[model samples]
Structures are given as C-alpha cells and as structure tokens.
Target: MKWSEISIHTTNEAVEPISNILHEAGASGVVIEDPEELSKEREQVFGEIYQLNPDDYPEEGVIVKAYLPVTSFLGETVDEIKEAINSLVTFNIDIGHNKVTISEVNEEEWATAWKKYYHPVKISEKFTIVPTWETYEKVSSDELIIELDPGMAFGTGTHPTTVMCIQALERTVKAGESVIDVGTGSGVLSIAAALLGAKDVRAFDLDEVAVNSAKLNIELNKVHDVVEVSQNNLLNDVKGTVDVIVANILSEIILLFVEDAFNLVKPGGYFITSGIIQPKKQEVKSALLEAGFEIFETLTMEDWVSFIAKRP
Candidate 1:
C-alpha cells in the first residue's frame, strides 16, 4: 500500500500542537525529527544506544512527519492540516518555518523507521521509560520501569512535560492515595502514579485514540489493575476527590480547568501542571493562585515549565 508522508518544519515550541493537528487530520502516527535529540545526553547505565545518523534530522527547525493513506482527497487533507497548524499562532506558539513537504512511501519502510527513534530513557530518578521492543535492566533497587508502545497518541513519557509530571508524582504520590491524571495521553502519567503506590488512578483524555493507547500502555506496564483509563473532556463528570491531580497539557488548556481541578482535589491534596511554555508560566501561576492553591514548587526543563501546587 502507498502512503503519503507529510513533513512539517516547525520549532520545538510548536511540536506538540502540530503533532496533534496532524493526528486530527487522520495521521496514524508521527515521527519527530529534532536536532536536539541527536545530541541529548543519556545515562550509559540504562544501556541506551546513541548511534544517531545526522541525515534524519533538520539543522535548524524540527521536522514532524506523519503518514496518511493516499486517498482521493489527499491534497485537501494536506491543505486543511496546514490551516490547522497555522491556527496555533493565535495561541502564541512559535511555529518557525511552517514549510510542509510530501512524499510517497510504503508501510514497511515507516514501520521500522520510526521505532529506531525511541529507546529506554530515564526521565526521572525513580521512573525509566522503556519502549516495549527494547530490553532494560533495573539500575537500582528502587527504580521503576514503564514499558510503553506509545503508538500514535503521543505521550512516550520522555517529553520534558511528561518527565516533569512523573518526577512530581514521584515526590507527591503517597501509598494508597488516589490520583487523577487529566489529558492522560498514552496513560503514561496514570501508570506512573499507580507504580508510585497510588491505589486508585483515574485517567481522562478527550481523544479516543489516546484513551485506547493509554489502556494498552497501562496493561503493558502491568498497572491496569490500578489505573483506569477513560475518554472525557477535562474534568467533567469527575466525582469525589483525589489526593493528587496531574495534567501535562497545554497551558491554555490548563487554565480552563484550574478551578475545576481545585474543587476536585481534597484539602492538602496537590495539583501538578506541566506542558506549559516558559512564556505562559506567569499566566498559569496566577490562575492557580486565584483558585486558592498554595504554590509549592515550580519545575522548569529546557523552555518548558511544570508547577506543583497544594490545596490549603
């Protein structure tokens, strides 16, 4: 079968939204080619392979590639994808050179090609994300491993936003406590919560693809017995209170549910928010403060930010 590979040249700040745009436009999965990943430092103890070839990445901006079946409306679909990506400017996301290129390829080529980019990454001190196809040994007695096949729903648990969320969970999740993971793409965060000793972990995502991917990953990591994955828009229909609520979504979306998150968290519970660009840190911080959450810690990685706030 023939596939139309759509490649977009954009910046790191716009990778998440652009990837989502491609997925919404019928992309089965995406390949993110960022030059930074080529030079990223890895812990040798994890036995991570770093034999990266330079030709796969762009020199300046990041390249996001997605495959779609070459249907009759292929041109129209590509145009719509471009339009949707352009819409991110309204969110103040830097799109860089939004040049898009298309090519013809076959499924077998992409099937193994994309898998080479993912490896076992120690995202936090306690949590290490291992691709289901790779084998990793636990480096420490207390180290926790999460095996995942992210598929096309994103959330590999290696992105800075996700890394920060899991790190916060490591510090905050208590034994037998409950956790709510909003926008639980691939169920990575929810699974991490369960592994951290949370007895009850409820994960929600508006995208059905994400819900399904999360379920697969949850079971793959053997956390399905503890974490429950479902499809829902934000915090709607959520009842009772949890000890911790974690969300690694865009800051603009985080603003939408800060109040709802506060109400859903019990007193002394925590709200951990990431997927925030550095520029929007103040805006998210203000929203949490206005919602009566006492700011506990602010975590920053690269140009991204994550906040941990306690309900007093």
Candidate 2:
C-alpha cells in the first residue's frame, strides 16, 4: 500500500491542535520535528543517547508530519485539515508560516519513519517512556516504564504535554484512588495513573480511533484491568466523582469543561490540565479558579504549560 505524508510548517504553539486535526483525519500518527531539539541540551540519564541530525529538523519554527493512506478522498481530507488548522488562529494561536506540503512514500517507509524519531526517554524522575520496539532496562527499583507505539496511535508519549501530565499524576495520584482521564488519546495518562496505584481509572476519548488506540496501549502496558477505555465526550455522561481528573488537550477545549471537571473531582482531589501553550496559561488559570479550584502547582516544559489544581 502507498502512503502520503502531510507536513505542516508552523510554530510550537500550534503543534498540539494541528496534530489533533491530522489525527481526526485518519492519520496513523504524527511526527514533530522541532529545531529546538537539535540545539537544546538534555540530561542523559540512564545512559540514553539522543542521536539528532540537524538535517532532519526545520531550521526555524516546527514541522509537523503525519501519514495518510493514499485514498480516493485524499484531496478532500487534506482540504478539511488545512481549513481546521487555519481556523485555529481565531483562538489567538500563532500558527507561524502554516505552509503545508504532501508527498508519496512506500509502505515500508511509512511504517518505519516513526522509529527514527522516537526513543526511550525518562520524562520525569519516576516515569520513563519507552517505545514498544526498544529494549530498556529499569534504572531503579521504583522507576516506572511506559511502552508506546507511535505508529499505532499519537506520537510517542514523550510530548511535553504528556510528560507534564504524567509528572502531575505522579505527584497527585494516591494508592487505590480513582482517576478520570479525559481525552486520553493513547491512554498514556490512564496507564500512568494505574501504574501509580490508581485502582480504578476511566479513560475517555470522543474519537473512535483514539478510543481503540487507547485500549490497545492500555492493554499493552498491562493496565487494562485498572483502566477502562471508552468513547465519550469530555466529562459528559461520566458519573461519580474521582480522586483525580487529568486532561491533556488544547486549553480552549479544557476551558469548555472546567466546571464539569471541578464538579467531578472529589473534595481535596486534583485536576491536571496540559496541552496549554504559554500565551493561554493565564486564561486557563483564571477559568480553573473561577470554577472554584485552588491552583496547587504549575508545570512548564519548553513552550507548554500544565496546571495541577485542587478542589478545596
């Protein structure tokens, strides 16, 4: 089978939303090539080596890529994707150049392209994300490992938004506590909560593709018994309050459901929000506060932000 690659040149602020647009269009997974990765210094914990090539990343801004099967409706799909991305400007997101290009590739190339960009990385002090295809040894007795396949879902669970969410989960999730993960995507956060000793976890995603992928990843991580994956809109039709609520989606979408999240979290429980760019941090912070949440902690990585708010 043949595949077509859709590459978008945009700013870091637009990465998460544009990736979602691509995924909704049936892209298997998205790849982010940020020039920052080439120049930034990283702590080489666990002797993990990062082999980066300047040629593979954009010189400025970010280049987001995704693969779509060569289908009869490919043109229409691309048009819709472009329109969706362009519409993000209304949210005050800086899209930068927004240049898009498409190219054909062999099935083998599409299948293996993700391997070139994803590797095992220790995203937090306790949680490390390893690709399903890689071999990684545990560095400590308490270290947690999350295995993901970018080809099967979203990007490797190492995006800053995901990293922050997992780190927040590590800080907030207690043993046997219940967790609700909204827009669970590949179910990475749900798996993390389960690994952190969450006895009952409910994972929801509106997209059926994301629901299936989350189910696969949850089972792959051996957390299916603790985490239940389902198809549902954010917090809607969700009954009962949980000890923790984590949502790693765009801040705008996060705003739409702040009240629901506040109401669904038990008193003194936590609500973790990520996938927020720097510019929108204050807006989300205000919304959470308005919904009667006390901000407990704020986490930032690169140009992204995550908030850990407590219901008092």
Candidate 3:
C-alpha cells in the first residue's frame, strides 16, 4: 500500500488547530518540527542525544506532517483539508507561510518512520504512556500502562502538558472518586482518572469529532464503563459536584470558564489544569485565585505548566 505524507508549514500558535484539522481529515500521527527546538539547549547529564540535521526543519515557523492512505479521492481530500485550514482565518489565527506539500511513500517506510518517534515513556511514577505497538513491562508492581496510538486528535499522549496532568492525577485521584475532565482531547486525563480508580468520570469536549475520538480512546483504554464521553462547551449544564476536575486545554479556555469550574467542584475537591504555556502561568494562577481556589501545586515540564488547586 502507498501513503500520502501531508506537511503543512504554519506558526506555533496554529499548530494545535491545524493538527486537529489533519486528524479530522483521516490523517494519522502528526509530526511537528519547530525551528526553536534545533537551537534549544538541554542538560547532557540527563539526556544523551544524537545531532539533528538542519535541513529537516523549516528555518521559521513549524511543519506539521501526517500520513494518510493513498486513495482515488486523495486530491479531493487534500482540497478539503486546505479549505478547512484556510477557514482558520476567521478565528484571526496567523497561519505564517501556510505552505502545504504532499509526497508519496510506501506503507512499510511510513510506518517505520513514525514509529521511530514513539516509545514507552514513564511520564509519572505510577503511570506510563506506551504506544499501542510497543511492548512495555511494568517496573513497579502497581505501575499503570496507558496504551495509546497516534492518529487521533493528538499524538500518543506524551506531550508535557498531558504528562503533568497524568502525574497530577496520580497524586490527586482518590479511589472511587468522581472526576470531570473538560476539553478531554484524546481522553488521556479521563482515562488516567478511571485507571486510578475514579468511579464515574465525565469527559467533555466542544468539538463533536473530538468527543467521538475521545470515546474511542476511552474504550481503547478499557475505561468506557467508568469514563463517559460527551460533547459539551466547558462545564456548563454539568450537575453534581465532583471530587476532581481535570482539564488539559488551552490556558485561555481555562480562564474563560474557571468560575464555572469552581462552582462544579465540591469543597476540598481538586482542580487540575494544564496545556498552559510558560508565559501564561501567572495569569492562570491569578484567575484561579480570584475564583476562590487555593493554589495547591504547580508543575512545570519543559516549556509548559500545570496547576492543581483546592476548592475552599
């Protein structure tokens, strides 16, 4: 079989929405190459890495590449994808170069190429996010494994923000507790909560496609019974207080409905929020505080941040 590799050149601010577009187009496993990574410095004591080639990345902006099966309607699909991307202009997103390129590759090579980017990663002490194809053994007797495959709304849930959410779940989710996961892209946090022993987990997303994708993932992780996936705009219309409220969404979205979040959380309950860039840390913290939340813990990984707060 043959595959079409679609690569889009866009700005960092547009990466999330464009990646979501590719997933909605049936393209699987996006690879993002940002020019910023090539020059960033890292500690060598904790990391041993090989040299990166400069030619593979765009000099500016970002490149989001994905693989789709070649079909007779391939051109039409590409056209639809382009149209959808252009639609982002209505949202006032700066698309940068917005140059798109397509190439053909055999299935064998495409599979091998993307697999090289994924591996079993222990994102937290108790939870490890493992690719569906990778075999991983639990080093600890109580270690939890989350089997994820790329090609959904997001990649195999190892992004720093997602990682911190899972780690926060490990520390805050009490057995038999109830949790509401807002903007549950790929349902990673909801699944983590269920796996951590949440009795009833409500996973909500505004996008219908994201809601369905998260439902499939919830089932994939065998937490369908405990985690219920629904299409919702933030926490509006949700009833009954929960023990924990987890959301791995944009910082701006978190700020918009934080008051609703506070109202839905019971006294002494916890709220875990992520998908926050470094610069927005103080702003989100101030919002939570204004909503009468006691800031409990703030976790940072790389350039992202996550926060856990307690409802007074």
Best by lDDT: 2
Which pairs clash (backbone N, Cα, C closer than 3 Å) in model 1?
none
Q: What is the lDDT of every predicted structure here?
A: 0.87, 0.91, 0.84
- For TM-score, the strongest prediction is 2
lDDT of 1 by residue, 121-230 (tens): 88787888888888788888999998887564664667788888998998899999999999887788898999989999999989887788788888788888999888
Q: Runs in model 1 with CA error above 4 Å?
A: 39-49
What is the alpha-carbon lDDT for the whole of candidate 1? 0.87
- Give stretches of model 2 more than 4 Å off: 44-47
RMSD of each: 1.8, 1.3, 3.3
What is residue 163's positional error in candidate 1, in angstroms? 0.6
Could you tell me the lDDT of residue 247 within candidate 2? 96
